[model samples]
Target: MALAQRLFRTKPTEQIVAEGGHGEGGELRRTMSLWQLTLFSVGATLGTGIFVILGQAVPKAGPAVVLAFVLAAITALFSALSYAELAGSIPVSGSSYSYAYATLGELVAWICGWCLMLEYAVSVAAVSVGWGEYLNSFLEGLFGWSLPAAITHSPGQDGGVVNVTAILIVLLATWLLLRGASESATANAVFVLIKIAVLVFFCVVAFTAFRAGHFSPFAPMGVAGVTAAASQVFFSYIGFDAASTAGEEAKNPKRDLPLAIILSLAIVTIVYVLVAVAAIGAMPWTDFDPERTEASLSYIVNLATGATWPGLIVSFGAVVAIASVVLTVIYGQTRILFAMSRDGLIPHIFQKVNPRHQVPVANTLIVAAFISVLAGLVPLGQLAEATSIGTLFAFAIVNIGVLVLRYRSPDLPRSFRTPLFPATPVLGTIFCVIVMAGLAGVTWLAFGLWMLAGLICYFLYGYSHSRLNTEVPR
Candidate 1:
């Protein structure tokens, strides 16, 4: 193939389907049902961002932070529709990477995969970095004893050598995943239910202190602030498409994956808006400090009830819930790499599944090791924005992918069709661009550097060995 042809060569849909269970190590075990897939996505999306980012977002948008969440959800809804349609049509473990390959071409597919690497790894690491403070909060609240601050916090957050608690949470989640996806999904389902209940409990408590006047002059900073906060909070919706990464492992991916994608987004949107409404109604947005966002809900509960125990319960719930985020996002990162590896874009080590457990054992461990370092040692506060930008970029690609595939293969069997056809997808792409515009200059710089590195890696490695270019042993 000429260089240009190699760069833009598309993967055939029939071949993508045929290669479903014929990867390098072995096929992913198909065990996930509709609800399990839904919970996987729920566990990923209803994550540390809402639990923490609310304090940060609220300060920017004031009481209209409620609107910020709604706006972010609206943006996500457009992408979710595209995801639902494409995931159902081209169900595969690669998620948007595979979609882009079958639609856009080899180069865009590699970039999409690279963007996913940044989105999943950095976001999960950021969440794990915050997991420590909550773990200590839960511990101190329950037993009146906490891990030494030296071990419990990342540097700059506290005078700590390492965030042992952060690494510990990642390790625990990794072990669960190593056992198998079924076990991991079961545990994540439990985590999702508990966190949902805790969030509801917080709403109940906060409403007790609700003041009608707290919402006056709702958009205190007006449209600009709300849009900026919407951009920031949009990161909260990053993992709604996580179920698509498990397509090879889903029992009926065509029907269930799209349902899980849409259903999980709906569930997350409702919970986030309810919590934001309760929060703003209970306390003035002026009191929200962006710096102290880790326990915003628990703090609200304590402030409302003037009782520490309820807040402590809230803290414990956040602890488990945040751990659930770590588990699911790490699973997402590993699976994305697994798909890339099978396509000869990365080392085959990532695709090597353990025979006994039917999981990518090495892939999980490698991803966990990098995440542990990033969470335990790095000051990741600024880098969180990078995830939002990366996610938005991938979302734009998927929206575009839907359009390309529809025109190229009109007869493709689609279990779910995006409402409004071209309008939905075009708007999805436009909305993603709008949100990406809200991100900071530093975030754009980070994204640019990241994408530059991805291109370098692709030219050096992925371009030379892609299965689309040269025959890759299956």
Candidate 2:
């Protein structure tokens, strides 16, 4: 095979476009506006991480946990800029995966898409599990009764068996996605409003209890701790870039893609910082216990304020918040797979859309099945770290892709461009690397194993079936 043929395994871009050819699938409906796209990103980005991750990270960074949130936001900003550039130029559905295929090569594209599967699919499962806990808390708060431990908690946590509630929630989201994209996005916007209101409510109540003494001895774990915690807390910011995935759907891809991404990131980052400040200041950072880290936001509010009503509201908000996260993440997962399948890198089933709904039903079902199994069986901590590693890896690739595309196809029409060019992407790469390095050895091992599996799949299936291998007629 020629070099280009080996790399892309399909017709070159010039030939493909000359023949008026795109991937196998039909175009997605371009119904989303900048505001909806921004909310989609926010809906995906804000969830369990802020409600649950703080307790785990605070012990590591002490008062410096606030600094960790800031660092993570800064790091996310770098990648968001890079994504804005590529997304504007490509204006495709697969986000970084599509951008990589167009610029990096087919093989690299497959790897990026595969890693994104981890970012979206596994993260949905992890978020669903968190949702289950909040739902149980909400139910108990309302009725003084909850599901059995075996059906509520994942296996190996508190000696539970399966997470039935989590699995059910995933299944429910799957059904909703199969209905249609417009329906899902509309419902997500509503959920986003409710979730935000709950967070604002918590901040108000928690801030009322704020004590300056709690912030004393700031940076108790020092700068090292701040960096470590920032790395872990970085996962909370993953969804902010999700707006880029809707590149093709944005009203004006070049203009709105970047705007949606940056606006969503800024909004979510502010919300997270405010919530963290309120939660920690309301109660001494030292008082946060790891064991109760999984409690509903309401529980945290109740503990801090000694009021059952605040906890009740918080629990209600968490139930809705986590459900929205699962729905949005799963939507993202199916769409990316749909893009891949249309490219002939995955089975055709992934690209098949239901005529009635115009959604990738098969892809949604497959993602939901995997996520349900994961939510039902896996531990939250292990699943969370793995998801983080996958997302960071994909973010790094998007940053690098921006630089590569700038050199390889500089004249290509781009609606938006990264402000600093090489410097911005370079900084983005470094920031992702630093965060990746902070992950535990076990997380790295899991990532390695996942990559190895991807390699095997590529050689066996993707390489042979890639659409790039097909020649376009003169």
Model 2 lDDT per residue over 1-474, tens place: 675557753223443223221234454566788888889899999887777888789899987788899999998999999998877776767887877777777888888898998888877877777666678788888899988888888898875799999999887788777777778888889999998998999999988888888888998888889988988888888898788777655667668888888999999988988888888878888888877876635566787778798888878877888888888888888778877887778898887766666677767888888888889997757646677788888889889888887887778777788887689999999999888887889888888888899989988998778766754522
Q: Locate the minimum summed-lDDT window of 10 residues in model 2.
A: 15-24
Q: What pairs collide in candidate 2?
A: 9-468, 9-469, 10-468, 10-469
Query: Measured by TM-score, how close is model 1 to the native structure?
Result: 0.95
* Candidate 1 lDDT: 0.88
The lDDT, on a scale of 0 to 1, for candidate 2 is 0.80
Q: How high is each candidate's TM-score?
A: 0.95, 0.92
TM-score of 2: 0.92
- How far is 189's C-alpha from truth in model 1 (Å)? 0.3
The residue-by-residue lDDT of candidate 1 on 218-325, one tens digit each, is 898999999889888887887899999998899999999999999999999899999999998888888988888887888899999998988898887888888899
The candidate that wins on TM-score is 1
